[model samples]
Target: MSTTTEARSGFSPRVALQKVGTSLSNMVMPNIPALIAWGIITAFFIEDGFTPVPALGGFEDAAGNPHLGIVDPTIHYLLPLLIANTGGRMIYEARGAVVGVVATMGVIAGSDELVTMLNLTQPSDEQIGQIHMFIGAMIMAPLAAWLMKKLDQLWQERIPAGFEMLVNLFSAGIFSFLMALIGFYGLAPIVNGLMNLLGAGVEGLISLGLLPLVSLLIEPAKVFFLNNAINHGVLTPLGLTEASQNGKSVLFLLEANPGPGFGILLAYSFFGRGAARASAPGAALIQFVGGIHEIYFPYVLMKPALILAAVGGGMTGVFLNVLFDTGLRAPAAPGSIIAIFGNATTDSYLGIALAVIGATVVSFLIAALLLRIGKQEEGDIAAATAKMEEMKGKKSSVAGALTGAGAGAAGAASAADDSGHTGRIEKIVFACDAGMGSSAMGATVLRKKVRAAGFDDVEVTNKAISSLSDEWDVVVTQKELTDRARQRTGSAVQVSVDQFMNSPRYDEVVELVQQRNDPEAAEEGTGSEAAASTAAGAGVGVGTGAGAEPSADEGPGSATAPEILSPESIVLAGSATDSASGIDEAGALLVAAGAVDEGYVEAMHDREATVSTFMGNGLAIPHGTNEAKSSITRSAMSFVRYPEDIDWNGNPTRFVIGIAGVGDEHLELLQKVAMAFSDPAQVERLEQATTTDEIRAILGDEKESDA
Candidate 1:
């Protein structure tokens, strides 16, 4: 709701790097379950971990000691296939995964020993190549997948009608075979060399004392959601190769170190006030223990200076990691204290714990210094409030929410005159640089709005802007990403909304879609048509959208629109006052009747403190926030009319509507409230009425309350 411009307004190489990292991160995310399972198998059953569960076969060693059999094939061959196929799916879709896995076999078997049916132990170790192949698979999977995608495109363009199946099947088989050969002959050697070179580079850095410098790129990238890609695509494979030789590799500790995030959250927990302070404990727990380091992204985003804190923490951790020469048997999946311990070597445990603790402490100190917690949060609130009031209804000046960036693109698109052109939109896709963190959240918000507004069939989804396709009906993205998304989506309706978190324009999208899907709703003043929601204070009604047309005023308990307001009870206004939260006369009545709790009244006040609830002319609807909904036992509605107007968020309120919704039922009820509020005549009539029954007629309510 703040009017400040976002820090992501411009682009730079760092931004692009972060995007690549995010792309790799999101691409590898679906494979996490597999990776975790593989890591656990390696850690527990492969004889490298504390409680070594035997996998292959246990036998006596040369010294008559028990030698636990290790499942070398599972880690060397199967894990690489799973990793490669996963990366493949991200690049070329499902078919890419099949090709990538198939081709990876070449890397696994290319220089390896072969058995002869005619002879025993015919192939010697000298004739065999035993490259771990994680690096090889990583390089070749994307290559094979890209070729498959290109071939699929070619087949689509040129394949003949009945021969399609035969040609497609044959082409895929040939390509898979060729890719395998190519992986063995071309990509595997190159990838193997590159892995060694990178591994050597790490060793060189450690020797030269430059290993800690990795944090310079890492901390900022982690802030941008590159945590997964940097860990899985770049680091994990390298660690596997080193771990194969040394029983563990410090490479595993590099990306999975949860220190920076933990540090940042720790700072917030101590220095932050208000909601930031309240949320920090949970966030810290998740970041450090749950291993979801992304939990602190917003904290850094809020104060960019905190990135330095993260950097300091990351560097400190890396320094300690190198100093101790510590490593893990497998990648710590969650990077949680538990996961790290689970994968830890006996020698590496102290180092890992120390590194994480050191980083956490460093990050906390830096973030606390940067947070400027001593500054009064609301010292400027009074001034800002005055400025806000002067600019009320002129919300377009605000940068990212409904009025700012979201308004420009969506407002233009949803304009009445632009309606004819946008009528074809059937599905909407939100695209972002990284996709999930911003674009996915944006898509979820819009989708909920779409469903709330009664357009269920309109598909809503998110993808990396790199994945935007021309087939999409519409593409939604932040202003900075719109041009890129437009170029990729190609003539698809592209809309730019600022701040993917909260778009004021999603309502516009819902309206446009409603009109497109239910043409009758567009007709103004239709007797049986639902009205599309505009910005806040939009009229709500029941008609062709979800509920039935307003039934003939049946006097209060009628099921005119069950999906609309399920009115539970109504009480006329009683002794209400001003200056506090609301004229609680209405709230007390509802609470007295058990329709809602006293908490509902307090919730209404809390909402009012942030913004006024007064509808224009003479009405106010009060309800707890989404977070406050836990106070309500069920979905219900109640109303209390005031004899005199009480100040409601600046506007006078004679009618107080109390709503408690379970699930999205409140959203359905909101439509009717909007309709009644938007009409000056109805509001005027309600103000003149002295009884709840008269108020019911004004609200298009036909029946008595269920109570």
Candidate 2:
């Protein structure tokens, strides 16, 4: 575990495998609808199907002339090409997909040629059949796409501007041609041999009665979001081949069996506690009836021990299938019972039904026992869901079902409803004249919030207004410069703010990014409660007027208090002529404490010049320019209360909290300060509190004096 942690911080072998499986699954998951269509067509039109159409099924027509049916061509060409294109896009987007398709065409042709050559050279009772090249497409597509990506990167910005189209077109074309040759001569034969090996291995597993053990792998992998990779990437192609020879193959039922998930959900409904118990019945409905196996993953994740149930159920299902000798005519996507029966062989209905029932019962019994043993340990459904998504690197579509109403508004209010931008916000930029002062500070603050919300992929950067590009998803700027920033880029959501530090709008921006990444989280009001609680512990929203007053037992002199905000740093009574003077006074306190240099005061004024430090709720946080970090440096904060409301820009400020943050060391403390003052009631209590100790208690944590 330590080695895994050192290998990749926050990622283990399980997560690494999940990522690989997800990537492979992504190539085929999108094309399941097409697979379903082909399956439906095959189930009805094949010669052995219920309503056999000779011409459509590729059988000899009434005139005895052979016809190429839709089924054979669809399987031989369409499906493989679709998989190749999808795989290519995964590597390098549309261009990669185009190259991938072109390369795969060569593999398909080479496979046919290989079969023709074999049939002629070794003509015997058993003629060599055409290899479908599904695996070949999966291999060649990504490889061709990756090569294209690397080739493009080499000439990326080096391409002479005006001739970019000409260079891109011809380069891709030439690269595609070369890749096709490689796929034909190099990849096709290798992939054919690999597929033959894999097929033989499966046959061997079946004959040896070891096939049921596959459930041991599939069940756990599914919980980690690798279900699609196993079911589609590995099983679907093999099943297609098997179905072509035999009327149906049991391979399709292996991973797509819904019994295990249903059983686990049923167990949760009976034995689980809290949100898991409440949401289980509904989740079971979605899992068993709706065919979304992902809905039950959180239940297993919330209690990893419950995986035994899934394994038990899955093994039971497989064993039953093997015992009954039942199979499906085509893949049953979503693993829904309806789809299962719909694709079942003419004689497989009873056996498949029994398999599902037996699997469910076994899983339920095992899961119920596990849940009963740990009945007191309530599952943190939201946390597990977040972990699952972290492992998946994206939100699951049906995972919301498990969270249900237990999901809270940990995230700030909905910003998409009012932010005026509906599109997804992936990249955010803070723009100012030089991008050195207020803009950089603002970006740092928002970036922290975004990270706290678990949006590691969303990029936040500070850029000079002149350097602003069209690719940004959200552009944050001071109201004074928003117009200038807008003129440079017309599409990005424009967020105007009055302050660089502790602005309410920052919360809105964080919420907006959160919504775009995880709509369910936003809808459920999910944010980082743990981070918030940590911040709260550091002191936030604990004021008397805020409805909570610390007892005499817990005051400023308490031993557990953070030392950053000590008695010397807090002034109960402070005075300033105006906002400018107040900011100077605040910076002077930091300078006096040796927390910053004299130059930091000037940067504070410069930052103020771009945007006011006056945040809402009668509070203002004056801070130096983002470029002035070198001026001096211990992380420190000072609290000054003005008895008279000082005129800050236009908003009356009763509290002026000065900050000199060193890197992100002061961010958690800053969050504490923001949360405390953001509330009007808390601000009111803060304004009325006469003692510095009283203010400390209200904010949350007490301050510890220097030893």
Candidate 3:
């Protein structure tokens, strides 16, 4: 939510960028359906030649030849209505929707209305009033919605019970009518004038050989998750106009080019690691053939500077469009090469291909340089393959490829985590960016799995990320949008997965739920030989290997040991009854006491599962792996003392001290801790201490001897 408490905390460049990017993405998300649907209609319903299908009441032309007969109203009516509804819905719900349509109609009104209403004659010399289509709808819809929203606020909760229906109906109708009048009389001329000015500026920029400069903003916007917004809300309308006038418009080629993404994935093929390498070819097939350009977004996000590759790629595509006059007749829904070629003009196909190739090559080279592909080692290849296996079925393909590959080093495969645990799970919800298309499909796949596993009592539903709640047992979202889901549901466990359609993790989730209904199952299944013990170092300050200081010299702050732990940081607890609750409490306590970042808790659990933190002598030290260093705000230690030992991965641990060390910065602390806990009797003495001063006396003695 706030770039992870483990990441930059406050006003940093990184956090600032996230806010800006998220804000832009939200603005255009709701309107995406209208944009894509309109583009689809234009792409297929319209004609390329006169000798088109004659199925719909085709009439012979002056030459007595059959031609296309069906009327295509995509641009004239459907697009304006769809855009108007989208804009209105952005401000309010159904009321805003009605106002938006009415306002759009109002904006398109002209003096010709007088001719119909009052029988006035129109002057032949005067040009008919031209309706502002896309731009006008966008403006008027929001304006109308705002006015309606204000009216609704006035009617807030005061209406009599029986009069509620009457008031609601009348309020919406009157507000819509009033807003429509405002749109016609006040906003129309001003909005239309601004639209024309913008059009002129764009046209001038294109003619002056500055069109490629557009990518500077467009590419960044795309990275901000506004690719859909820019493509649909702004560019598609402009392209529609150009297509009407010139049969095709280069404007469509600017943001919708798949070349840059294609190029990045191609580079990953050569330079990327395990999952990344294995997933690249499949992603390429989907990106190029299936037209889902979203598959490549995660790759770019891995390195934000990689956006330059997109900019360079987009600019090159636009450059070729200018040089060769290439443009598609409609927006490319999937932004795939196949779609682009399908929608392009016959004469421009070769030019479009060349432009795409140029973008791909340029981006690939840039991405390769950025990735430093040659540096990856062969040992990681097997690990990556295993991660890829976690993603099962077409969910990987249907959702987007390259998800598991990018998080190659995450290493989520842990005995404790991979194995099911005992926890009640009544609800399972699949979430996504929009939480409709992909998530719904994912929920269906998971639901089938749940049923097949004979767990039909479990509820599985899909909803948008914004609608996610803490009441749900497990909330799953796509890898890229996991932060958004986390922000919404802090208490609920959030699963970061690549695809919603299908994943091997679904079975694990179901198994966990089953184990929850029968907690004994988890214990029975997990019964195994005691894990290989760590060094059974003696009491708090008794015996230690005389040569142990050599290993200490190689630890944190090597060649320089510093006093890192303090008595004031320790907290003595009566006992820990439950391992699960205790671990969570310990992690949260560290965060609350300002000892570590919020992300450290999750990372520490991950690290604990990967490698047992139990260091014997009734002690278990939990610390995140070096990879989790970013989650550490500063180097600090949190000591939670349990009088009665608790089960720590089957080992009894009396102390669960969490260390938030930056990389290997906690070496000095570890050495001091080792010396303090060296004697078995010293640990016993400290455990019996009732106060901080008493505990300090024991530690103080060890410090005195070390000095």
Candidate 4:
């Protein structure tokens, strides 16, 4: 024998029986409560208006009704079977047969409808036979299972690691479709064969005086996974005829698993305790009348071995039921209460009592014995803990940091320099209304920009516009926030941009900063001195230009009088500067031109709300997508924020704001802008510059002269 089979054989009969019993109990325990509730509902349906027939008279009713329709009883048995069977399939195989069951029912019902339609005129016998075959095919279909399995395998093989969740949903859809087909055409014949065999054996068992013993075993056994599969997977799709409505079928009692209920009652009856004693009566009330059985989860979990005992008792009960030729129209999940109203023979109550007694005795004895023997380890606690710890650590790593950021953007950058403030601006505060949306966006944009700009010691934060103070080094704000920022930072530079929020502008902003810091270097390549000399000659030609020119602050050659303005400091901030480009597309162009880091542009796309930075009128400023702190080396500035407002979140915006940072370098850019804006002429000159090249020329010339 194989190792597995040898292990199985090593168990003593009693132990082996106990193991089977536990598996059965585990399968049936959770379903008991829902079954009892459904059973009561079935009873009500029959009692209200449905008619009962004598052909289905075996099952007793609490109301003492002699007749009940097959439909009502069939429903009672069918629903519980469906739930138990489906639950079992889900537990064991992680796949449910419900779709197949439904499809089978639909095909049969549809075929019946077609026959009825034909009968309205007049139907032939052959036609009816054909319809029956069609129904049979529908009920026994197998194609569904094959299709579902194929699709599951395909998804498992092809789906990438990060996208597993999306694949699971796709697999579920395929599985559901296949199961529906199986229910219709793959299950009918098997049910019929079982019924035929049952019919042949019922009489012989009664004649042999084996009815009671069979009843004792059969009823409980049906509660296991195997019988549950047949009941739900087969009998339910057989069509709810009048016989089933009248509670005539033997299938009803097979629906519910009374093993757990019996075990609980016996336990309480024999070992009454403080809470256990009090709960016993309630348990009996629910089990007997309500038919709910989930009251046993705690019991089983506490003493798992008892589960096997319960299963053993259930199996015995089912066997006895079959032997007695007892049957129920409706299936009961927790069989205790609803079985009373199901279809049965004249001695139906005897069958119920026998099932209860047999199952209880077997469960109690086994449970008591197992309890005395002590518990076995079902799982390794230490291994489970270690596994959990490992998972937790993985979750805290870089991969975990990017879950919501989308596959394209996750873990794109480490948090090594993400503090927002590192090199320079330690007391920078960004302000906007509500301090939530716009300010947050502005802070993120600046942080990323500063980080990229190589300043790692800048601290940038956001606050409500009204909360600004003089403690801030550079107060950055939207036009709407300018007034409040001014009040908060007296004497400190209040940099107000026309855009709603600051966005990444690494290239242009960095270029502007470089020029401002070193005018000689900026003028090195560009003929700034020559441009100034030409402008001076033109002024001289205007007659008073020579006289109007301010006298050199120093005598002729004394260090050439600090020019007072830098050429490269000039910039406009709006979308009109690049009419042919989207903000991101333009930002990309700038990045490619040694303007900004590519990471900043990528971050803008990741946030989904990158366009929000262009608040209104002739303006489009894209910001960083990350909420985590970061920075850029410099901010990119454009000439005309924008002449006409671009459609930004449905509002018109004119400014095209771009910020690029190395790391915490935002404060320097802010200070530079503050100094530039301090002179109104420079701002006006930028607005009127017309072309991007002209703007660059004007700013370039101004910086050299100032130096």
**Leading candidate by lDDT:** 2
Better of 3 and 4 by lDDT: 3
Residue 256 accuracy (lDDT) in model 1: 81
Quote the positional error of residue 407 for candidate 3 in Å.
Answer: 14
Model 4's alpha-carbon lDDT is 0.42
Q: For model 2, name the residue pairs that clash.
A: none
lDDT of 4 at 599: 74
Least accurate 10 contiguous residues by lDDT in model 2: 405-414
Sorting all predicted structures by TM-score, with the top scorer first, yields 2, 1, 3, 4
Which ten residues in a row are the worst by lDDT in model 4?
A: 393-402
lDDT of 1 by residue, 1-707 (tens): 12111111223444345545545554455555665565555655555554666645234667878654544666677777877877677678677888888898887666342212212444555332245776666677888899888878875858775887888778778898998887767676676666667778888988999988989877876665455556766787778777765668888888788998888888877777665566677778877787866557656655668899999999999999888878887777767888888778778888888999899889888888877653425122122222321122111111122111332233234542242321334678977553422344456546555655666667888776766655466677766667787666543556667544335666666666655455455545452222333322232332233322233253335453442333346656545656253437656655765657788778767755643444334555555654566777765666766678776645556666666656544443344444455445556666676655565665655443541
lDDT of 2 by residue, 1-707 (tens): 64323223434665566656666666776787887778778888888877998778887767978798898888889989999998998788789999999999999988888888888878488686677888888889999999999999998879885998999999999999998998889888998887788899999999999999999989998887776667766788889888776768999999988999899999889888888889889889988988988788878888888898999999999999999999987778768899899888878998999999999999999999988777557887767765565455444456546654212111222422332222345688988764543455567556656665566677888877876744466788877788787676554556777766566677677666655455555667544633442233233432222213233234444342455565678887787968899888888888878888899888888877876766556677777766777885777777889878888888888888787766555554454455455444566777787777767666655642420
Q: C-alpha displacement of 592 in model 4, angstroms?
A: 26
Ranking of predictions according to lDDT: 2, 1, 3, 4
For candidate 1, which ten residues in a row score worst on lDDT?
Answer: 393-402
**What TM-score do all the candidates reach, one by one?**
0.51, 0.60, 0.49, 0.32
For residues 248-303, what per-residue lDDT tens digits would candidate 3 score against the true structure? Answer: 88888898788888898898888876666677778877887777675666566555
Per-candidate clashes, comma-separated? 19, 0, 16, 164
User: Which is superior by TM-score, 1 or 2?
Assistant: 2
Q: Give the better candidate number (1 or 2) by lDDT.
A: 2
Which structure among the candidates has the greatest TM-score? Answer: 2
